[model samples]
Target: MIRAVAFDVGETLVRDDRYWTSWADWLGAPRHTVAALVGAVVAQGRDNADALKLIRPGIDIATQYAAREAAGRGEYLDESDLYEDVRPALAALYAQGVRVVIAGNQTARAGELLRALDLPADVIATSGEWGTAKPSAEFFARVVDAAQTEPGETLYVGDHPANDIVPARSAGLRTAHLRRGPWGYLWADTAEAAAADWRIDSLHDLTQIVSGAG
Candidate 1:
């Protein structure tokens, strides 16, 4: 039985594309351009946080664009809006008595982002806090330690195969793959095809998986 569940923050639990699209629009460039830039950065093997720093110069252009959009509409694009869409699923997991923790690579701004979105503080665990990244057995081990759960009793759900599935499984934790789109190292036309110990297409599907409803 799965007693605890861990999640990845960016694309798995939250809709990262929303923020990227917003940021792109603010920069007065096509969204795909920014997407390509990010892809290139990742291709270069720079971690997400470091890539952001390398690309900081381009951010001003986007910020200026967003400012103009806000002025024109007399409203602001708040990152908090994205959280509203995700909180219900998180709350549902909590209600199920599954100890939920976020195991991800993030920067110091992650706390600010979480607070801006009003996400629960008690459940978070990040590389920024832990000083390691996923796909490392040690990283998952740390999560297991933090949750006070054994490997067999824990499940880690994430979008990347290398970062989420392979490592979690290696560390002896059960795994679930959340298939959102064509984004990660893992590709499953549907969640069922992901070949994880369990598979889910949406956050709502998680309740049944965790509760053994299926």
Candidate 2:
């Protein structure tokens, strides 16, 4: 039985369309262009940050991020940014006394933004806080530590096959691949993605997996 459920923030609980659109606008690129780059990068099993570097090369990313936050433009995600299925599923799991952790590769302001959006989770953490990002053993270890459960009893749900499913499984956590976001949809039929304990179309499917209803 799974004792803890860890969710990836962007594209898993919250739809990041607005976030990416805003970033593209700020980067002086067309939103659709950024979107296509994102799809292409992930379809090749590459990291999103790599796509950003390829698109906006030679820019001081950390300084740019700092400037964005200082100018109050960084907090882009809103309550409505969440997928419709997220709340109900999280609430159901919370009601069942399962630990819910939001662990994602987000910026320093991610927790504040999440609180502002009122996303529910027993613990909210980011790769920045843990000093390691996903696809790294250290990152998943931190998530398991935050969940306070054995790796085998923790279920990691995310939209990225490479960043989420593969790494989580490698770290001994059960994996759920949600086929909605760029990486998720593009890699849905891949062998690595197929290895997920649950291949779901939405967060609503999680209730069944957690409760053993399927």
Candidate 3:
């Protein structure tokens, strides 16, 4: 039985259109141009951070992130940024006495942001805080440890198959490939993604999927 479920943040619980658009605006680049690069990067199984550097050559990433934070506007996401399927799906899992965690490659302020949004999760972790990112065995091991469950008892749900599903499965967690975002749909037929225990069109389908998994 799955005792806990770990989720990816961007494109899984939330759509980051406004967030990326804000970044593009700050960097003085066309939003559509940056957004296309982002999609292309994910499609090619490259890191989003790598795409950022590619988009703006010779820009210091840390300095850029700091600048965005210092501005205090468009640096954080709110309830409006979340997917319609997020709240209900999380609520349903909570009602089942399942331990829910939001574990993803996110900024240092992600915990504070999620707190402000009042997301329904027992624990929220960001790679910046955890000191490791997805697709790394160490990170997934840490996530399972944080959940206080054996890896086999944990289920990871995310849109990114390479970072989220494949690695989590390798770390011994069952995986659900949620096919909602560009990476999700685009890589749906990939060998790594196809290995997920379950694949669903929406997060709302998670309630039934989790229940059935039990």
> In model 1, which runs have C-alpha deviations exceeding 4 angstroms?
18-31, 37-85, 184-186, 189-193
Better of 1 and 2 by lDDT: 2
Of 2 and 3, the candidate ranking higher by TM-score? 3
For TM-score, candidate 1 versus 2, the one ahead is 2
Each model's C-alpha lDDT? 0.67, 0.85, 0.85
True-structure lDDT of candidate 1: 0.67
Cα lDDT tens digits, model 2, 37-153, are 877777676766565677788877788777888887765667688888888899988988889999899876876678676666888888877788888999999999999999999
RMSD to truth, every model: 5.9, 1.6, 1.5
Q: What is the TM-score ranking, best to worst? A: 3, 2, 1
> Each model's TM-score, in the order given?
0.71, 0.93, 0.94
lDDT of 3 at 160: 87
Predicted structure 1: clash tally: 1
Give me the runs in candidate 3 sitting further than 4 Å from their true place. none
